[model samples]
Target: MLKAPDHQVAGHQARDGSLGPLVDGSGHFYKPLQNLDRGSKELAFYTSFNSMNGIPPRIRRFFPSFHGSETFQASDGSGLLPHLVLEDLVFGRKNPSIMDVKIGSRTWYPGVSDDYIQKCFTKDMKTTSMSLGFRLSGLQVYGSEESGYWKPSKKAVQSFTVEDVRLALRKFVSSDVGWASDKDTLPDCSLATRIYGGPSGVLAQLIELKEWFEDQTIFHFNSCSVLVLYEKESALRGKTHGAAVKLVDFAHVLDGNGIIDHNFLGGLCSLIKFISGIVAEANKALHGLESSADGLELH
Candidate 1:
C-alpha cells in the first residue's frame, strides 16, 4: 500500500483490499466538484506524456511516472470524480528533500500594454501571477524514521527572482565544462545537467522542448512547479551532486493549434539573454579571483 505524500493535492493511496487504486478523493484546492475540469486536464497531460514516444529519454526522466486515473463516487452521492495516480517521489529513498515551487508570473508578460502590466501590480499580484510559470508554493523534507515528514529547509523554500535563476544557470554552465564540451554530450548527462547546461545549450533545449510542445499543440504550461530532488548520500554531501529537476502541475495547461505563442517565445528568449549575461559576469568574477590569487603569491 502506497502511503500518501504530505504534499499531495488530488488523491490518496487506497487502503487494504480497496476496490480501486485511489481512495479518499479530495478535489483540487479542497473543492471537490469545482475543480473537475482542471483535474481532467492534468490527467490528460500525464497520459500524453506517458504515451508519447517522441519525447527524449533524458527529458522524460525528469517527470514523475503517471499511473492511470480513477473515478470515485462522492460520498454524498454528488457524482463521479477523477483522481490522478502518480509515483510517490520519496518512496524508498534514504534521505530525500522535496521542494514544490511554482514557476512563472501569470501577469508578468513581456511587451504587453502598460494598462495590462499596471493591472498586474495590484493587490492580487500573486493570485493573478500564479499562472505565469512555476512558483515555489510548498516544501517538504523527509527524515529516516516512521515520522519521515519534516518541515522544509530554508533553502528549499527560498524564493528566487529572474536574476537569481539566471545566476543559477550561469553557475551550472560554468561548472560543467565536460558536459558543455559537446552539444551532443548534453543528452548523455543527467536531466539537471542538460537543462542547466551552458547558456546556449540550455537555451537550445528550451527552444527544442517548446517547439516540440508546439508541434503537439499542447497548451503551454503556466505556473508549474519545478521539482528538485536531492539525496544526502550522493557526492558533495548532496549539496551539488546528483540533483534532478522535474516540472509538475498541469491545471492551467491549454490545448492549442500547432502554433507557438509569440509572447511566450519572447519571454523564453529574454530569459536566455539574462542567463548569457550572467555567464559573462561569472567569467569576469572568476578571472578577478584568479588574478587576486596571483597577486597574493607575488607579494
Candidate 2:
C-alpha cells in the first residue's frame, strides 16, 4: 500500500493542505505531480536524464534511480493522480536521520515570470539562502520511538541564524540524548567524523559532486535539494551507518546547452565548505578527547 513517507524532511506536506510524497513497501517513493509547468519540467528532466548516454556512473550515482511515473490513489483522498516513481532512499532503514538542503541563493531562473521571480527573491532574502547560498529546507532526526522524530518547525528552520545552522548540522550527526533541545551543545565528534569525514562520508561525496558540477554544462538546477541520510541507530550502536547523499527536486531545472551551471556550482561549493569545516572541527575535538583520556590515565 502507498502511504505518506515516514522520513520526508521538507516540502509541501499533507498538513500544508497539499498532497505530499508517498512510499510503497517495495522500495519506491511516489511524489504527486505539481502544477502543469513545474511537473512537466520535472518529468522531462528525469526522462531525459535516465536515457542520456555518456554520463559518468560516479556522477549519476548522485541522483535517485528514476523508475518513471505511475498513477496512484492520493493519500489525501484525492482522485488517482500521476506520481513520479522514485527509489525510496530511506528504505529498510531504522531510525533514519534525514536532511534536505536547498542549494542556490536565487531559486528562480531567468525567463520566469516577473511575479515568480519577485516571490523567490523575497523568500531568498528572508531565509539564509541569500547569505549562505543554501538553506536547511528541513530535517528529521530519530530521537526514539517513544519520543518520535525531532523535527524543527518550518518557521523555526526559516528563522535559523548562522550559528543555528551550524548547530543543526552538528545535531544531525549527534547520538546524544539531549539532541532535541534548541540550545547549542557540543556534539560528540566521533559520530560526526565517522559519518561526514571518512572516505565515503558526506564530505567526500559532496566534494565529488562539486567536482562534477564544476565542469558539467548539461543542465542548470534551480531550487534543487541535496538530500542527506544516515541511520542514527546504527551510528549509535557502532554499526555500519549507511550514509547517503542524493540530488532531488528538479521542478526548476533548466537546459544548460553549452553554458556552465555557476549558480548550482557556487551553492555546492558553499555547502562543501560547511561540511569540510565540520569535519575539521570534529577531528580536532576527537583528538582532544583522546589526549585528555591519556592524560587522566597517566595521573
Candidate 3:
C-alpha cells in the first residue's frame, strides 16, 4: 500500500522477487545484506536503534539506529499525517549516519554465516500459501523441519471460523507487536501499529474500525508479495447454498505472491470507520453486547 516517494515507504523490486530488505517469503524482495554472520555483535548493535521505521521506541531502544529514514504516503484525506516518514528520512547534512558507526564486530546483515532459518517454500523459490482470515486471529509463526507444512500448535490453532480467526490474530499480533483490544472489540492494530512511537498506552490501542466495504472478508496470503482478500457483495440467484469464498488477484505484489493493492490501502484506512458502525449497530441490537476480554496478556 506504500505510494510514491517523499512520503511513501522506500522499496525496490528485487530481481529475485522480494520487495527489498530481508527477502519476502519469496526470495525475490530481498532486504539488503539481510543475512549477516551469526552471533555477530554488530548486527545486535544496529538493531538496537534501527527503526525499520515502525518499531516502537521502547522496543527500538533495544536496538541500533537505522542507516536512514524513508517515507510512505497515508491514505486520501490523511491531512497532516498524509505522509508517514521513517526518522532521519531526510537526515543528510553529510551526517556521519548509521553506516559510519564502525561495525567493529561485523558488517551489515549480521548473523550471516549461520545457516539461514531455511524456510521451505513450496516452489523452487521459498513461498507458500496461508489463510489470513477475519479478525486477524490466531496468526502465529510456524516452521517445519522439513518444509512440509504450516503445522499450527494444537493448543494454539483451533477450529477455523470467523470468530476463531479474529480472536487468534488479534491475540497473536497484539502480543508480538505489543497491542491490546476488547474481547469482541476487534480493532485493527495492524493499522494502528503504523502510527507508532506515541505514548505506549495510546500506541497499543486498536482503531477497532472494521468499516471498509460491507460483507465479511477473507484474505489469501498466497505468497509474501501478493496478498489477496475477497468478499462478495451478494449472490446473484443461482449460486450454491454454501457461501463461496471469493478471490481478488494481485500478482507480484511483494514477490510473486503479494499484492499491496488499492483496496488493500483503502481497507486499512476504512477499517476503523467500519468497526465504528459495527459497534453502533451492535449496541442498538442489544445491551452489553460489546465484550472487552479479548486481549494479549501483558506478562
lDDT of 3 by residue, 1-299 (tens): 33222211212323243323321121122122222232132233234324245444443332213343232222232222211122222122111100000000111122223332233221112110122211221122211123212224333343444345434323321212222323444433332121221123111222211121122232211211111111111111222211111111111112212333233334333333333333333333333444321121111
Candidate 1 residue lDDT tens string, 47-134: 8779987777756765777767655553334467655666555445445555554444552344446785677545125331233333
Best model number under lDDT: 2
Q: Rank the candidates by TM-score, best first.
A: 2, 1, 3
> How well does candidate 2 score on lDDT at residue 174?
74
Ranked by lDDT, the better of candidates 1 and 2 is 2
1-299: candidate 2 lDDT, tens digit per residue: 76777778788775444688888888998888886688878989999999999899999999999999998677677788888889988899887889999999889888989999999999889888889889999998776567668898988898887777888888787767465764445555457777887778788888888888888899999999999999877877778888889999999999898888888888888888777776766666667654433212211
Candidate 3 clashes: the total is 60
TM-score against truth, every candidate: 0.51, 0.92, 0.22
Error of 2 at 121 (Å): 0.5
> What's the distance in Å from true for residue 117, model 3?
20
Q: Which 10 residues in a row give candidate 1 its minimum summed lDDT?
A: 25-34
The backbone clash count of each candidate, in order, is: 15, 0, 60
Candidate 2: clashing pairs of residues = none
**Candidate 2 lDDT:** 0.82
| RMSD of model 3 against the true structure | 20.7
